[model samples]
Target: MVNPYGPDTRGTFSFGIRLGLLFEVQAACLSAICVVGLLVYLGWTAIRTRRQRGKHALPSHLHVLFVSLLFSDLLHSIGSILNIPWIRDSGVLEGPLCTAQGIFRQMGDTGVALEILAIAVFTWGVIVRGWSSPSLKTTFVIVGLIWIFVILITLVSYGVHKAAGQVYYGNTRYWCWIRSPYSLPDGIALQYGWFWLTAAINLVLYISVAVTLLKSKRRCRNAQMPEGQRSLQKIAFQMTWYPIIYLITITPMSITRLWIFTNPEHPPPFAATALAAVLLTLSGVFNAVLFSITRPTLIPQKGHDHDPTVGGLRSIYTLEFCQRPDEDQRSSKIPPSPETPCHGEGTSKGGGTDETYV
Candidate 1:
């Protein structure tokens, strides 16, 4: 009798053998649980928001990018969760199901990376560059472009591989993906490159935003920074954690994949591969937890939307730092009123006015 699975045990099938398969199974199961919890939370929130329709309308315009990110995470988690079936069977092989997993994995990963990048860029523009929130048409256009790009790349790769009589997606030791032989081109082009790109851009944008806020704070320090400025600064710092968490979740798996790519002759240790799978699968959970931490108030209180402290992450979208230099002189002439509390009031000691971003 033959082992049937490849001898890549050391040089192949790192997780293919029964001894190491448990790790992948466990990782997928864990991801499923978290994904379900996230779904429940979203559903519950939707129900509550609907019930309070008169008091609170869904801030779909504000959270367009956010909702897209959550959808991507869902697809990615489902791809990982697919591994549960393989685990129960004790083996994986190339087939339609395998192909489906690979496609979902690639699409979801690419979508998530792109969505994160979009959010980071949008946030920086609004907060640091002083740009207004994007119009709904522009938002949908951007989101559509991202999905189109992801689909085109994945399908193109699949077509090319199929036409060449190759497996576009085949079994790795643990899960199905671009397969070992084509991992270099397909992996980098379809999946990992997006992750790396998002990581780099997000790190830079959030850092720049944080630094800008800090500088603004220092300028207002003597005058005593207004609560609005202070809140902006705090949120800026908190936003940095988004990229950090993203990096942490993807790093272990990235390292393993790169290691395998460069040194095909020497497969990583079983423990390394297993650990990487576990970490990578938990990305959805990591993202969910990070969002919860960064954006605590998903639904604003009935009448507290204007309250910066209670606004949560929504404040970043709705609050402006200081008025633009052009608006300052004119805005100051108008007296503050109930409808515009932060308009002309909240002046700093330096004769500059601090207004909540309207």
Candidate 2:
């Protein structure tokens, strides 16, 4: 019997069904587990922070942005997890589930790309441009604007298609997304455009930040370099993984999608498609690993305020270099130790600051 959910001839639907059997379902399941693991890690960290409430201050602006990025990744992973249903059915069907999957995928993909770009920009601003960390209020406003844009585009594009009696979130390949005919501009403008743009911007911003940090590191080799300066350099070294992880996760699927767009007649190679799916789905896992690796002190313990340990989430989440508070005016809540004096009140000659707490 012929499958009603797909065309009788060769096309996206047929290939998608074949592809699902070969790979998509397994990748989707693995991705779902990874996303869940990341969520549990973050949740546990938050709980630990809460128990130690006053000891550790609330999360910083940069920390909030990172959480937002993870939230977006969660959305994307949910979308990928939806693939199980389609793969089990062995074909794509036009229905609410399909629409939901498509919506989640678009929103998640767009959200991740935008968030990555925002982080890159913020990091560049703080490190390369020597700008002060933004206020929590400002960070909320920025996040609000990004979500507004994400929701607005999603509504407008999908709504227009619905009104015109068109299938905007229908089968394009192994998933429900922009279908044929309108897939070019609609898909590109709504999602892929942001991905590619963010990738390019990430490359430039990260390269600049890396260069600035390298210069600071070289200067830090001098015996006269402040301990705080050395700390900042070490933190910067760990941060080098940010763009590296992003590029690895985003590039393969991006190329695959672009190829499908350009050469619609010839489907992407089976192995290539499978690889892209696996890599793309593993984004959350990669990010979670990076988070743990870079933010060693995500859940700081009490009494460690004076710990000589430098770098990690202390820089990403708590450091505030902008105000450069007067030494006398600094809060006495967290006393400074000779080994790890609160850098909140001073700046190094190389323009780095210890600002390790609001």
Candidate 3:
């Protein structure tokens, strides 16, 4: 293949650039929606919780999980703001500009993958051990560590490319990224070593979560736990959908990239690249809808919050705390119909939010 900035021998640039730009731009628009929507949601949550003044504290752990995701998604979306007009006019960017774009894109890509894996672990922790929400200090620590890791890994790619003395962030097909990542050491590390490994781990974690849920169900079979208190629907939805959607969206790009590596003699199809570009670019958007917008439906509303012992002692004495949610949910006292528990109820709290989580 000819260098994107070099001679135009392969005739690849003619069709590839325009097609890639078109799809990427569309994906950028969707990415914008994802970022804006998430920010609004986070802001609203913060203000609402503040007004409540500790009366209705939000779940810190869940907040950390989603906020970290938002940060990663924002990075992913930022890379979508390509200099289309500039690119069309100049036909090539300066080396530094190209390098920056490449780095930014990879940060977003790997960041999202890593964040998803984090979420899987979070779900498992809450389910298997009745883990509480993270403290404010812990939240910052986790987020900081994630960013630090991202920065270090991205720098590794940059260092490798610099050492090669080749044009770093050279134009690949239509866009800028680590060129020939499958072949180059730095590129391969970013793509194959980091990104793929995260996705693989996420798969394993989710599968483990599913199996654990089944075993838990068997253990609590005799208990009269409300279905909502079991949080089966919510857990099942995430455990099933999160990994599945991620795999589905990422497969096309993974396949196309690997194919190019294995079979360089034949060029990849334009249609395949277009599909991959759409999926890659809109990943943030899909995640916002799946992980953010639709997630609240699973949380039990304050008024609708079901008391695990609503039916009286007949059910309470026989109910297993193992099958019940957090301790606040197991409390025998009758809470006012409109009053939220001081402690947060987890997914197993009969749709109630974690009360002690505050």
Better of 1 and 3 by lDDT: 1
Candidate 1 lDDT, tens digit per residue, 3-120?
Answer: 2234222333333454455665566566666656765776676566556443433443335666677677777777876766566666576688888999988998899899889988
Worst lDDT run of 10 residues, candidate 1, spans: 349-358
Q: What is the C-alpha lDDT of each candidate?
A: 0.66, 0.66, 0.59
Model 1: per-residue Cα lDDT at residue 207: 89
TM-score of each model, paired residue for residue: 0.77, 0.79, 0.74
Off by over 4 Å in 3: 1-17, 55-59, 86-94, 129-134, 159-166, 180-183, 218-223, 227-236, 297-358
After TM-score superposition, the amount by which residue 237's alpha carbon in candidate 3 deviates from its true location, in angstroms, is 3.7
Worst 10 residues of 2 by lDDT: 1-10
Model 2 collision count: 0
RMSD of 2: 6.7
Give the true-structure RMSD of model 3: 7.4
Better by TM-score, candidate 3 or 1: 1
